[model samples]
Target: MDHALIEASLGELTAANSRELERKCEQIALSYIAQLVEPQFDVDSADFARDPRLICADRYWNLRFQAAPTLATAVDCAGWMAEHVVAAVQDPIREKWAMGYAFITRNSVESAAEIADATADVVAADDSACNKAYFAALYHAGKLRANFFYDELEIFLAASPLALAAGPHRESVLFTALRAFAAFGSRTTVHQHGCALLDQMWNSAERTFAATDVVLNGLAAGKDFDGRAQLLRDRSAEAVAAYPGRDILHFRLATGRWMCGEYDAAMADIDEALRLLPAIGWRVSHELLQGQYLARRDAIEAARAADRQARIDRDRVQSTEREVDRLAGEVRGTVLRAVELVTVFAAVIAFAVGSLNVSLNGNITLADRIWIVVTQGVGLLLFAFLILGGSWFIADRLARRSERRDRPED
Candidate 1:
């Protein structure tokens, strides 16, 4: 194996993307596997590990497993790669080999546990580079099955600060740290630790925009429970500026703005993201956010209309009450006037009867006097009935009019 050829091949593999890369990686791994089985090629020699292409091939196979459509297929490929290739890899590269194995074996508790044990051994050896690789592998393995490895993840995070001090591993260490915090950190600690980690990355001149996006995106997904939408918006804005033309970053920024109640700005950002990549998912997201903002605006308007109507109804009810009180007062005055007239009429009738009795007392015979008294009594009774009945009719008419006026509108 020529070293220059291996370097060129690995360089090509790194550059290729999509289906072409997959095909090239597969061909390379199979060719290596064929060589391993050949009788002439010594599998146990240092020459086997000397060619960096073997490690590169291992990485390609890992990529192939990751791209597998189903977990079962991925696991099968991972198992095959571990048995045929990874097990034969020499010591220094074995940590990377183990990390690849752990990544694909995540769905299986048994296989994953084996990888974890291997990772622990690598970590115990205290090789800075190897431990970094091991921790990265551990993080990837636990990422998909966090519930199974929560305790181990916590312990790893506890040692992250010291491990991250070595500049070569800082990026990988930071990535694992973000994932660990997102998965296991408390709501209070998630934002605190996440922001602190992000700040470190941002301040580090060596950090790449791509690396910064990873932490930002991870924090966005995990820290949703914190309700610090404004914080998300601010950080996402920074990310957008740091990584221009990354549509995903713009999308995330839009989401943050939406959460912060800046709908118009959010929509503008969403539109820009869509312009960059007009996928159906982004369109759907755009419509959903638009609908929410419109719904909220409509709800506010409806509430205002309802409140205004309530005020109008209250004023109308007060006016009606005032009118009813005035009608009641008029009724009282009418009743009092009727009472005064009746009293005066009764006094006049009483005085007339007394004078008639006195005039008849000396000049009239007994029969005549009796006739006069009977006739006068009947006349007085009729007069009194007429006066009282007329007063009652007027009062009843006024009371009925007041009731009609006071009746509520339908």
Candidate 2:
């Protein structure tokens, strides 16, 4: 548990030198694995893979789970996101919640409902407290209801005449008016129904757009943060156009613009948004947004600097390694020359010994000499193979380790 020990263990995992080192490295890896086992973190395995094909961000995917514009694309995108979510959720009960969510996103509401029911059955089967799961489900259901609610109202409003003199259903007028009670000072009555319904629909859309703006603004302000941001952008843009001069609407548009890489426009909108936010007390969210925006910009700059340094380090390492290899090759040549001299001297001594007792040497037999020759040849071949194999393995491992070290984290 010592901090230095853990740090050293992590270092070994990155550059292990022996089997024992590797075993220790594996133990260090398990420490991180233990973190994954915690239910809250929901770490996804596939997402950690080097190359994850990502679907381009779309607004609807944040919602009542609208499909991508094309059928095939929707399947591909939703499936990828679902896989990541499932991998992230380790708990069986919670994992199913993730699955239900992914299914709802890719399929029809009926299909989504079936998935949700199945997820509930799985949770119930465990006989565990699923109060959290139940609440999560309820909250999402409410959002989904809200998402569709305005769409329905919009349709109803379209059919209704501008003036009540045209005559629509009393029930529709009554319900719409009830929903609008807070927005417009008075409820819609048959007597003053003409303009009230239209006002109600506009007010409803404006409120929906405002709520959407908060969520999206939070998301856009965070680097690599996805979800609801695009939806906020689309909905708030519409709201701004529909209800001009609601300063926050313009602010939301500018924030969305900033998130999408339109920095100039975003600055313009933030200028306006800041002026209006004082009254609404939305400065906290705006402050967080500005902080995140600055942080990401700083991160980008830091990453570029780190990348340049890594390239320089890699070049220096390769140059040093080449120098060492060249020196080693020169030394190898000197060793070969020394070995050749020794072999020549040994052969001379053997020949001289044989000549002193030619018949006795003949009696010693050609097979003996051939045996000596064969043993030397085999020994030399074995030595060569061992040297080459060991060097190759060590060099390959070092090269791979160096490459990994030199690679940028992001």
**lDDT against the true structure, each candidate:** 0.52, 0.40
Off by over 4 Å in 1: 1-26, 33-59, 63-116, 120-152, 159-180, 183-190, 223-227, 263-410
- Which residue runs does candidate 2 get wrong by more than 4 Å? 1-226, 237-247, 256-265, 271-363, 404-410
> Which residue pairs in candidate 2 have backbone atoms (N, alpha carbon, C) closer than 3 angstroms, thus clashing?
42-88, 43-88, 164-194
lDDT of 2 by residue, 85-185 (tens): 45333233232222223334422323334434534443443322132333233223323333343333233333322112113222332234322321222
Q: Write the per-residue lDDT of candidate 1 for residues 288-395, one digit (tens) a residue.
A: 434544454454345556666887999898887778778776777777587757755785677477647755688788777777767776776677677777777877
What lDDT is reached at residue 109 by model 1? Answer: 40
Candidate number of the best TM-score: 1
Q: Kindly provide the TM-score of model 2 when superposed on the true structure, using C-alpha atoms.
A: 0.27
> Which run of 10 residues does model 1 get worst, by summed lDDT?
38-47
Q: Report the CA-based lDDT of candidate 1 relative to the real structure.
A: 0.52
- Which predicted model would earn the best lDDT? 1
Candidate 2 overall Cα lDDT vs. reference?
Answer: 0.40
